[model samples]
Target chain A: MIELVLSFLKLGAVSYGGGWTIVGLIRTEVLRQGWLDEGAFRDLVAIAQVTPGPVALNAATLVGHKVGGLAGSALATLSVVTVPILASLALGALISRLGPRGNRFREALRSGTFGLLAMTVWAFAPEAARDPFAAGLALGAFGLAAFTKANPVLLILGAGALKLLASFVLA
Target chain B: MQASKPPSPLRLFLFFARISAVTLGGGYVLVPVIARGLERKGWMEEKDFFSLFGAAQSLPGPIGLNAALFAGRALAGLPGLFASALGVLVPPFAAILLVSEAIGVVAAQKQARAFLDGAFAVVPGLVAALLWRMIRTRAWNPGRVVLALAAAAAMILAPGWAPAFFFAAAALGWFVETPGTKA
Candidate 1:
């Protein structure tokens, strides 16, 4: 239990850029620690996606549960959030103290985040590239999301439905 | 109709809980949803909300969780922070636990596999759209674009060096983008 808390605590602190990068970090840690195999990790990512809230939190909770049941889940969730809470408070203080000049720091972080997000796209590109149909579907989704105010949840569900329908027809 | 009276801790907690329960696609998506919710509730003004959001983004950890903490702290101090964080966390915590237990059964079917594969494939696009939105909101400058490209290249070429890359970018951004620096 202590180990679980400590591991996630470390991850929570360094898991910058959020989103997919955090997911990748969790995947690496879990695999390295022998807490979950690759298949289970994949399922966790999928589950994290369809469910609400931050994927990193969801993944941490699931991992905690897998490792140490209810207690583990509680601890892991707390561990993952502890640093973020403190960091936000600190950043808030810094912003108030520095005023407009602080804006540069935020901009820099945002720039770095853009890069990290691009890496996320790069990481996932191979999966889409494996199948031409999947690639086309992804491109279409990108266009819709970029141009329209469509709900992302619906877009994801719609893609799933299309895939199911296509598989049925083709098979 | 903005309420003159301050919101109770319970109200603050419930507000975030409701947001966390319904909003999807992760932290980035929550920005607008949260802004709208807070605006409608009159708990915060627009400028304050964005400032808080910017701080949340700049800080390490999950953006959604960080936002919740900031919102809670801003509203009711320490107790409010605990209340809001708990409220926002419980739903996802419960949902993930349930899903993790049931995933084995659900993932076994062929159709489920195909559906998940398809949904997963769209994630990159979703993220890309998010990046595009971020870029659009910012001033287009050579330095910013160059830094972003460098970080992305490092991330791809050497996955293990992500933390170092992010730190380097942050340092460079501080130096190059800071006030009084030559454009």
Candidate 2:
């Protein structure tokens, strides 16, 4: 239990970029602790996605609920967000010395964010591409999302429907 | 939209709560909704809200949550900040908690399982798309390119200590981007 809080606290501290990067961090840590298996973890991530809110926050809440019930849910949710809230309070104003350096600093973080995001992609790829159909769905999603302004929720739902239909026909 | 008088914390809370409840796609999607809603309500202009967003990004945490915290503060100080946090957080937690129980029943269906598998499959592609956009938008020189590749390699190799590598990369970015700040 203590380990759970400690890990989230640490995870929250460096969860730069956005929800996906944070999700990768949580997935790695949760798996490391043996709290859940990969298939289970992937299911949780799916649930996290369609549900409202930040995916990482939802992931934390769900993982917490799975491991330790309601109390765990609350603690993990709050714990994961603790540093971000504090950082917002403490440093939100500081960003706007608004000088040239401020903008440059944001630029500076981009390389690392890019790296973190790269790692996130690396982590998710093989698992997402394990089967040819799955690979096709993922590639199609990439093309649609990258090239057009298609909504993600629709993409996810559409992918799910396609798979359900495929199962009916294939089976 | 003209700037109105400061909204009450409850108003801020309820406002964010509505956005939190309705917005489906997560932070990147949610943040824009908040921006627009705030603008429509005359709470903060889009430009000011986005400037705060820029600051919020530098800090850790999800962009939507951080944006809420900053926007709340900008609009109504500490009370607004806390209210916005609770607003953004509470609905989702409650909703998930309720869904968590129901998910078991839903997961039992074979069709549902197939659907979930397919939904989950596109996650990597979505993530890759996001990275592609990030890469495209950022100002990158050859030095930054080498640095980014190195950082990505190091993080992939040692993800457990990824934060350290990321911060190190950030410092290196500062060094490389800021020509002649090496006094």
Best by DockQ: 2
Compute the lDDT of residue B17 as modeled in candidate 2: 95
Residues forming the 10-long window of minimal summed lDDT in candidate 2 chain A:
A95-104
* DockQ (Cα-based) for each candidate: 0.58, 0.65
Predicted structure with the largest TM-score when compared to the true one: 2
Please write out the lDDT profile of model 1 over residues A25-109, one tens digit for every residue. 5665687789998667766766777899987888899899999988899899999888877776556567656556666766766
Model 1's DockQ? 0.58
Displacement of the residue B135 alpha carbon in candidate 1, Å: 3.1
Report the interface RMSD that candidate 2 achieves against the true structure, in angstroms: 2.7
lDDT of 2: 0.86
Model 2, span A84-122: residue lDDT tens = 989888877887664677766766777777777888778
Candidate 1 regions with alpha-carbon error over 4 angstroms: A1-7, A14-21, A31-39, B180-183
- The residue pairs in collision within model 1 are none
lDDT (Cα, tens digit) per residue for candidate 2, span B56-143: 8878898889999999998899999999999999989999999889888987789998898899999989988998987887767787
> What proportion of the real contacts between chains A and B does each prediction keep?
0.63, 0.75
lDDT of 2 at B117: 87
Model 2 chain B worst lDDT run, 10 consecutive residues? B174-183
After superposition, candidate 2 runs with Cα above 4 Å error: B179-183
